[model samples]
Target: MRSFVYARPETIDGAVSEMTAEPGAAYLAGGTTQVDLMKDEVLRPVRLVDITRLPLREVWSDGDALVVGALVSMEELAGHPVVTERLPLLREALLMGATPQLRHMATMGGNLLQRTRCRYFRDPSVPCNKREPGAGCGAIDGFHRTHAVLGTSAHCIATHPSDAAVALLALGAEVRVRGGEGERVVPLTDFYRLPGSTPHVETVLEHGELITHLEIPLLPRGARSGYLKVRDRASYEFALASVAAALVVEDGTIRRAHLALGGLGTVPWRVPRAEELLRDAAPGEESFAAAADAALAGAVARPDNGFKIELGRRAVVRMLSTLAKES
Candidate 1:
C-alpha cells in the first residue's frame, strides 16, 4: 500500500475541512472497503481522514422516521431493538451482507459508499472505465457473469453490491449529508449515479461531502417486508440476484407494494413497473408472476449471465409471495 497521511479530527466540520483541503484524501470510517483497495494499489489516496471518533453513531426513531447515524456499525444497527421490531427486512439484509466479525466493523456510511465488486475494477492490471476512465472496459466481453444487467452502459457494467442499501431503497430511505456548502438530504435511489458516458463518477456526493445519517420514513404499521438473496454459495458471498419486497395488503388485495432489486443493476434497482403491477392486484401466482416479469422487462443480460434474467425474476416472485403469505 502507498504511504498516506492520517488524521482523526474531533469534529465533523474539521474532518470535512481536512478532506476538502485535499481532494485526494479519503474519509475513513470503518476502514473496511477503503483499506482493501489501498492494499491493492487501486486507490492511492494521499491522505486518510479518520472519522470514527466523531459522534455520528446515534440510531433512533424520529417523529415518523428511523434516523441512523452514518457511523453506526452494521452489527449494532442490525440487532438494535427498533430495527428488529420495525424493520426486520433491514436486519435480515445487514446480517446477510457480511460475516459477524466484518459486520462489527462495517459502518452504515461505509456500506452505502462501498465500491462495486467488479473484478475488472479490482484488478488494477485489467482496464476498467470505472477504475480509470477512458482506459477501456475489460468486462465487456470478459468474465461478466457477476456484472450488471440493468442500468449498464457501453463504458461499464458493474453491479452494486450493497445489501443494506437495497433494503433501504425498498423502504424509501434517504441519506443526510454534510457537504462543503451545507447539509442536504438525498433519497437513496437518487444518490447513486448511473454508468453513463462518464463511468468514473459513482455517486452524487461532492468531493469531500460526508454522509451524516440515513433516514427511513415510517412505513405502514402492518406492512410485511422481506429480503431474499440468491448466491453461488450459502456463505457471505455477493448476491447473484436479490429482492427486497414490502407489501401492504388490505382485505384480500395489495394496497401498496415496494420492490427493489440488487445484484442485477448498477444501483439499487427499484422496480416501479413491478410495483405498478402489484399496487392493487390480488396476491397470487398470476399477479406475482406478472410483477416479476415487469421487473425484468428492461433486463439486457450478457451471454454468460443470461440466466440472471430468470433468476432475478424468480427472486422477486419468491419475495413477493413470502411477503404476501406473511401479510
Candidate 2:
C-alpha cells in the first residue's frame, strides 16, 4: 500500500473538518473495503481519517423505528436481539453475506459503501468507467456473466454487491449523513445513483460527508419478511440473484408488499411496481408471477447475462411465495 498520512479524530466535527480540508481524504472505519482497494492500488487517498473512536456504535429502538449506528458491525447487528426479532429479513441478509471473520470487521456503513466486485474495476490494468471515468468499460464486452441487467448504461454494466443494502432498501430505510454544512437524512432509495454517463459517481454523498446512522420503520404486526440469495456457491460467495421481500396478508389477500433485488442491477433494485401489483391480490402463483414480471419488466441483458432476467424473476416469485406462506 502507498504511504499516507493518518489522523484519529475523537469528535465527528473534527473528522469532518479534517476531511473537508483535504481534497483526497477518506474516512476509515473497519477498513474492510478501503484497505483492499488501497492494497490493489484502486484507491489511493492522500490521508486516512480514522473515525473508529467516534461515538457511533449504538443500536436502539426509537418509537416505531429501528436506529442503527453506522459503526455497528454486521455480525453485531445480525445477532442483536432486537434485530433478530424485529428485522429478520435484515438479519438473514447480513448472515448470508461475507463469512464470520469478515462480518466481525465489516460495519453497516462500510458494507453499504463497498465497491463493486467487477473484475475490470478491481484490476487497475483494465479500463473501467467506474474506476476511471471516460476510460471506457471493459466489462461491457468482456466476461460479463455477473454484470447487471437493470439500470445499465452503455458506459457501465457492473452489478452492485451489497446484500445488506438490498434488504435495507426493501425496508424503506433512510440514511443520516453528517457533512461540513450540517446534517441531512436521505432516503435509501435516493442514495444510490444509476450507472449513467457518469458511472464513476455511485452515490449522492459528497466528498467530505460521513454516514452517521440508518433508520428503518418497523413493520406492521401481521407482516412477514425474508431474504433469499441464489449464488454459484453455498458459502463465502456473492449472490447471482437475490430478493428481500416483506408482505402483509389479510384474510387470504395481500395488503402491502415490498420487494428489492440484488446482484441484478447497478444499484440495489427496489420494485415498487411489483409491490403495487401484489396489493389487494390473493397470495397465489398467478399473483406472484405477475409481480415477478413487473420486477424484470425493464431489464436489458448482455450476451452473457441474459439468464439473469429469468433468474431474477424466479427469485422474486420464490421469495414472495415463501413470505406469503409464512403469513
Candidate 3:
C-alpha cells in the first residue's frame, strides 16, 4: 500500500484548509475514481482530505432550481422523486452509469470530477500527458479507438467518461464550489477545460477549491428528457457513444432543446449547432439527421477512432428521433 496522510474533515472549512495546507492533497468523497487511480499509481497524493462527513449531502430546492449536494450518491440522486419527475434525463443518466454497488458509493461531485478512462492514463507504464505531463500521449497513435473526437488536443485525446455529466450539461446545471476566495457558482458547461496545451489541467478549479453542490436550472415544464448510452457491453460498461437529449414542443414548433454527447469528446460535448438546428424546427427524421450532422461537423478523428464520428452522429440522430416520438 502507498503511504499517505488521511484527514476526515467534519466541516467544509476544515476540508478546504487541509487541502490548501498540503500541496499534493486530494479530496476523498466516494473514492470510486480516486482509489482506482491511486491503486494504479496514476495519482500519488501525499494526503487525502475526506469530505464525506460534511453536510454537503442534501437534496433540496431553491425555488425553481434543484439543488443536489456534492456528496449525494448516484443511486440516491437517480431514485429521488424530484429528480425522477422533473429531470428524467439526469435520473436516466445516473442509472446508466457504473453498476449499482459503485453508484451507491459514487458521489455526484466525484462523478463530475472523475478522471478520463484512457488506457494510457490508467497504465503507469504508458506515457500519458494527462497522467504525466510532457511524457507524450501513447493513445495519440496507439490503441486510440476510445479517444475523443471533439475538443481534443494534439497532446492528449482522452475522452471524458461520465454519463451523468452529459445529462447535467444538457440540463444547464451550475456547479457550486467553496474555495479560498469563498463560494462561487460556475455554469457546468464552463467548468471543464479543453485539453489544449496543458492536458494535465482538466478543470478551471484551483487547488484549494472544493465542489460543494450542483444545481440544475429550471427547464420548460412537461419537457421530455432522457439519456441513451451505446456501449461495447450490454451492462456495467462505459459508453462508446451516448447522448443526453431533451425537447419541449408546443404548437407544432420546437420550443426548448438541450443536447450533449458523452464518450465522444474531451468534455461533456454540448452541440449548440445541433441545438440551433433543432430550435423552431418541426420534429422529423430529416431535422434529426441534420442536427446530428451539425453536432459532428468539426469532429477530428484519429486513425482507429474515426468510426466514432459516424457512430456519434447516428447516436445523436437516434436519440433525437426517440425524443421527438415522446413529445
**Candidate maximizing lDDT:** 2
Model 2 Cα lDDT, one tens digit per residue, 140-233:
8899999899999999999999999999999999999999999999999999999899999999999899999999888887689999999999
lDDT tens digits, residue span 1-327, model 3: 389999998899999999999899999999988898898788999999989999988999889889999999999999998888889988898988989999999999999999998989999998998888899999987999888999998899999999999999998899999998899999998999999989899999999899999998766678888799988888888888999999998887788789999999999999988899999999888889999999898899988999999999999988888877883
Candidate 2 positional error at 4, Å = 0.6
Q: What is candidate 1's CA lDDT for residue 218?
A: 61
TM-score of each: 0.98, 0.99, 0.98
Which residue pairs overlap in candidate 3's backbone? Answer: none
Q: What is the C-alpha lDDT of each candidate?
A: 0.92, 0.94, 0.91
The lDDT of model 1 is 0.92
Candidate 3 lDDT score relative to the true structure: 0.91
Winner on lDDT (1 vs 3) = 1
- Which RMSD does model 3 reach against the true structure? 0.9
Task: Name the regions of candidate 2 deviating beyond 4 angstroms.
Answer: none
TM-score for candidate 2, please give it. 0.99
The worst-scoring run of ten residues by lDDT in candidate 1 lies at 318-327
Model 2 has a clash total of 0
